[model samples]
Structure formats: structure tokens, C-alpha cells
Target: MDNVISVILGGGRGTRLYPLTKERSKPAVPLAGKYRIIDIPISNCLNSYLNKIYVLTQFNSASLHRHITRAYKFDNFSKGFIEILAANQTIESMDWYQGTADAVRQNLRFFNQPNIDLVLILSGDQLYRMNYQEIIKEHIRTGAEVTVSAIPAERTQAEHLGILKVDEQGRIIDFSEKPKDEKIIDAFSVSPSVFDRHGIKAGDRTLLASMGIYIFNLDVLNTILKETRKSDFGKEIIPDIIKKRRVCAYFFDGYWEDIGTIKSFYEANLKLGSPSPSFDLYDEKAPIYTNPLFLPGSLINSCKISHSIISDGCFINDAEIQNCVIGIRSIIGKNTRIQNSIIMGADYYESASHIRANRFKKIPNIGIGDNSCIEGAIIDKNVHIGENVTIKNANNIEQLDAENYMIRDHIVIVPKGSVIPSNTAI
Candidate 1:
């Protein structure tokens, strides 16, 4: 892996995951109580022994930059470094990153170094544990110029992903970028024997969808980017090169979920608190890495908690939490009942003086106050919910944009640094 370099694309304007992406970038969104979304890919690279990494960021990247700087610090002897390549305005290109391909093209000078043989492209906002060495070795063995990591996806799931048709040798022959037409999607389906050959169970998932992961030969990538003005890899670059270059599919039958939208993000987090989660966070061998906050264990005072993940430095007093992910430094007051929700906790604890001042000013303290009921919602970081607050969507409205919260796909999302006063209802 010495000759390999990894580039993680921090997505542009995460509109689907808005409110969460309102202040921070998509990659900086908190996940499973403790870790950030970007931590998943960076930890995968470090575990795979691919140390040299560059994260491409464009929109609302301050928090993401801070987390990366604090979490990853390598010694001088290891020759491993994780660098951030933020979008810049230069003489060559003055506009922002038009798409993923454009983002890479703008930063090609860094990746086009002599020591780097292959450039591994990854999405920053995905949840998965992958040994990237396996894909790189397969790329070398097959002599493929480009290799895309693919996963078996069902028909309903295929409409939102880049679907590919592969030959017997696993070479991608035909490609479609998020085709909504059922006829086109059905034509791209793979045979059951293909799944059997790979030892993956072929249930209803017959189509091989791209996981938005790619490996490209240094020379081929430079040549392709120089020849075309294609702005995206999935929608333009990958589909265009499939007919001309040696593009192959690397099948991955692992637990991978793209946290792109509110509905997907909500479900993915709740699943982590399940009895048996598909994405494991307890694997010691390939452990996920994050910032080390030297905080004390949670102080639970007669709280009834079931099937939940409560992070460090939390203080819950007589609260009933079930099927939820409570983040770091969270404070749940007495008689609060939280179910099927995510409470992203505060960054800094409010001192007694600060709390007194907040009370003087008629503002709720920086955590969940007493006598609150929250369900089917995502409470972002540093949110203040006062006593007698009810956050459940009683009307079952699918979409809404209010002053304090926004509802998308029937899940109410309280934006970061928001405040809901006493006796409030949603």
C-alpha cells in the first residue's frame, strides 16, 4: 500500500441531510453517538495500512477540519500523514468544485506525485469497514485501469445508485447512473450464478450497484481528466470510461449504508442501537478511531435505559431512554422520556454561572430540560429543550420547515444550537 494514496470526497452541500448539514459539512455530521461520518473512511484507511490520505472539502468544512486535526496525528518516523485539501480559487479554476470529478481534477497536482501509483477514491459520508488492500490487489491482478467497488442492491435500491452490468470475468460492460426507468434497471441485472460464484446470497438483490468507491491507475486518471471536462465520477466519468477503458467491478458483500438523506441517516443510527447491528463498532482488530475526550463515565440517576448507546460525559437524571443514540456531554433532566430519537449533545458544558445567567435571561439551559417527551426526531448538537416540551410529530406531516425545527420524511430535526422553550409542541 506504499504506492497507494487515498482521496476522500467530502460531499457538496448535503441538502438531503439539511439542518444537520446546516452548520457543519456532511462529513462532520455526528454518527452513532461519538464518531463523525468522516472518521469511518479515515479509520478504514489507517487500518488498511494506507496512511497517506487527502480529504477534499468544499462546503461548511470548519468542524470537519477541526475533528481531523484533533483525531489524526502521526509521528515523523511513520511517514504517514492525513492532509486536507480544501477547495481553493486559483488561476486555473476560479469556481467551486462543480462535481466530484472536478474536485479531483482541481487537486490533481497533489495526487499526481511520482511515488503514488494508484489513487483510491472514496466517499466521506458512508458507514462501512473495508480492507482497501483487497481491492488494490485485485486491481493489480486483473490489470484493470479502473476498479469500482460494487455491492448487490435490490430493484428499489438500484434507482438511487449507479447500476452496472458485469461480464463473467467481473468486468463492467454496461453502466447506468441512477436510472429511474424500470426497464433499463432490469436490463442491468446480474444472473444468480454470478452471485453464487462470489458466494453472496442472491435474494431479491440482483443488480450490482456502485458503492461510490474507485481505484484508478495514476496515468489513466490524469489522461482521462485532461481529455474530458466531465464533472462527476458516477454520472459522467465512470460511465464514459467503461466503454473505452478496462473497468472492473470488485464485489463487496459487507454492511454498507450511504448516509445521504435524513430518512437513511435516521434509520442507520437507530439500527446501531439494535441487538445485532449490521455495522459493527466493537471490532477491536479494525477499530474505528475518533477524538479522545478525557471525560468521565455517564452519571445515570435512576434512569431506565434500554437498547441505547450513551456516550461519555453524559448526566441523565430520572430519564427513560429507549432505542436512541445519546451523544457526548448530554444532559437529560428529570422525568424526560425519549424514544426513537438522536440527541447530539453539547460541545462545552455550561457552568453554574452560565446556567444561572440563562435562567435570568429566560432561556433554557443547554440540554434537555425536565418533563420533555421526544420521539421520532433528530436533535442536533447543543440543542436546548425546556420543560414540558413535546417533540413528537402528532400530525404525521411528511415535510415541514418551522422556525425551531424542520421535518423531512416524517422525522423532525432540531437544528444545531436551537432552543425550544417550555411547554412547546411539534
Candidate 2:
């Protein structure tokens, strides 16, 4: 682990998660109540005792940079540090990151340093906790040129993921990216023995799907990038390199979700309030780390909150919250009913005089106002929901672009710093 360097890919534009990604990168998007999506992988790396990490981002990286800089600060004596490598127009290449492999290629100078044996590549937007030391251990034991963390996927999930066929020795022989045809997908399936070895049911028709978590021998990574012109790993590089290199599959059976879309983003946040969440953030032994805001406990006054997670410094007064995740510094006014939603709370709290001034000027201060009904929505930071506003989207719109908000998958997304006037209906 000491000889390994971790690179988290956060350079995607994240168009699928539009309004959320409108102001920040995908990795910077808020998760649960207080944590960001990048926090998951970074925390996992820290828990594995791998501290030298580089987060690569090209689009809307300001907030991500601030959060990382504030949250992770190593002691002066230690060499451990988390650095941000934003896309730059160097003389060698003036283009932005073309793809995953190209992004690594452009930043080769930083990673091609001393005493680095393995380069562990991970996605920043995934929601899962993995002990990367296990993958590195297997990579060392097997003497593999490249090792990919894979998971057992059913047919429904296999179509969208990178499916691979492995032999008895756990070496990947063939790979396909998002094959829609059933016959082609079946051909890329692994044997039942593979599932049995991973403790999965033998009768299940599951194929080994790449989780996009890879460990590359430093020398091998340098060689592949120098020889090939492929842009992406899953789409082009891995499929071509499996024939020339010893590419092994590391099976991982755990909770993993790629919340890159609006629907998935919404569901993943809402699922956190469930009785038993798939991803556990409350694990004390391997807890997720984030920016420590020293705010007071949430104050609830005559509110009925059920199966919800309310973060710090919330002022809830006579509100009914159900199956929601209320973020830090949230303020819910009286007679508000919110369900199946995620309120990303405020970045900063307004003073008493500021609130009075805003009220006098007829400006909605922050958070939900009184007599509001919000369901199936994602209210980003600094949103001011006015009184008597109905944001139910009763039409069940699959998609729409309203003046105040956007609707995707029947979920209204109020982008950051939006203001909805009073008595508005949607």
C-alpha cells in the first residue's frame, strides 16, 4: 500500500445529472446529507492506509478543490497528501481530457515518479466502500499486469456494464461494453464456478462486470499508454489489452451504485433514510470522512419526522418530514410537508437581522417557507422556497425545463441558488 498511488477520475462533465452538475463537478455533488460523492472513494483509500492520492477533474472543480483542501490536511512530517490535478493546456497536449486513458496520459509526468510500483485507478462518483489493499494484494500474488475489481451482474445489469468472460484461473479472456443483444451478452458470461468461488449462488446467470476499479502495474500502465491510442479503458483499452497482458478479475460482492444520473442520484439519496441502507455511512470502524462543520444539533419544534436523517443546525418548526435527508443548516418553516425528497440545506446561515430584512423586502430567505408541499424533489443549496408553493409535479412529468426548476424522471430539481416565488404551482 505504501508503494501505491491512487488516481480518482472526476473529470466527467456529468450531463446526465444536469442541474446538480450545473455548478459543481459530479464528484463534488452532495451525498447523504453532508458528504460529497468524492468523499466515498477518498475515504476508502484513507481507510486502506493509502494516503498519496490525486483527484483529476476538468469541469467545475472549484467547490471540489475547496472541499478537498479543507477536509484533508496531513501532518507536516508525513509525506501523505491529497492533490488535485486539474486539466491544463500543456505544450505537449492542448486538448482537454479526451477520455479516462487520455486523462491519465496527459498527467503522466506527475505519476511517473520515484518508488511508485502500482497505480490504483478509481471512479470518484461511485457509492461503495472497498478495502483497496485486497485488490493490490491479489495483484501482487497473481503477478498480474492489470487487475480489475469486478462484480457479479445479472442480465439486466450486464447490458449497461462492461461484461467480461473469465477462465478457471480468473483471467479475463473477452470483454464487451454495453452489449444490448442477449446472445452476445450470454457469450461473454463466466462459468458457474466463478460465481461459486466468489460465494455467489452457482445457479445465477451472472457475468463478471467491471466495477471500473483497476490496479495497473506502473510499468504496464506506462507501456500501454505509450503504445495505444485508445481513449477509454472500458470501451477500448481493456478490451484490447486483455489479449496482450495478464488481466485478472477481482470479484467484489458488496453494495455499489453508479449514481451518475438524476434518477439514480435521487434514489440513492432517498434510500439513505431507509431502515437498512445498502451503503452504510454510520460504520464507526471505517467511517466516511468529510468537512467538519462545527454547527449545533438540529432543533425540532413540533415537527413529525419519520425515517429521516436530519443534519446539524436545522431549525424545523411544525413541519412533517418523511423519508427525507435534511442537510446541514436547513430551516423548515411552519406547516410544511416534505416527503421523498432531499434538501441540500444552506451553505451559510442568515443572521436574524438578515432574515428580517429579506422578509421586509419580500424575498424568501432560505429553505422551505410556511404552507409548502414538496414531494419527490431535490432542493440544492441556497434555495428559497416561498410560502404556499406546490412542487408536487402532479402530472408525473418524465422531463421538463421550467423557469424555476427542471424535472427529470418525475423528480423536480431546484438548482443551486434558485428562488421560487410564493403561491407557485407545478
Would you list the C-alpha lDDT of every candidate in the order shown? 0.95, 0.91
State the displacement of the C-alpha of residue 372, model 2, in Å, after optimal TM-score superposition.
Answer: 0.9
TM-score of each: 0.99, 0.98
- lDDT (10s digit) by residue, model 2, range 12-61: 89999999999999999999899999999999999999999999999999
lDDT by residue for model 1 (326-358), tens: 999999999999999999998999999999999
Worst 10 residues of 2 by lDDT: 197-206
Q: Give candidate 1's error at residue 4 in angstroms.
A: 0.2
Candidate 1 collision pairs:
none
C-alpha positional error of residue 27 in candidate 2 after TM-score superposition, expressed in Å: 0.6
Model 1, runs deviating above 4 Å: none
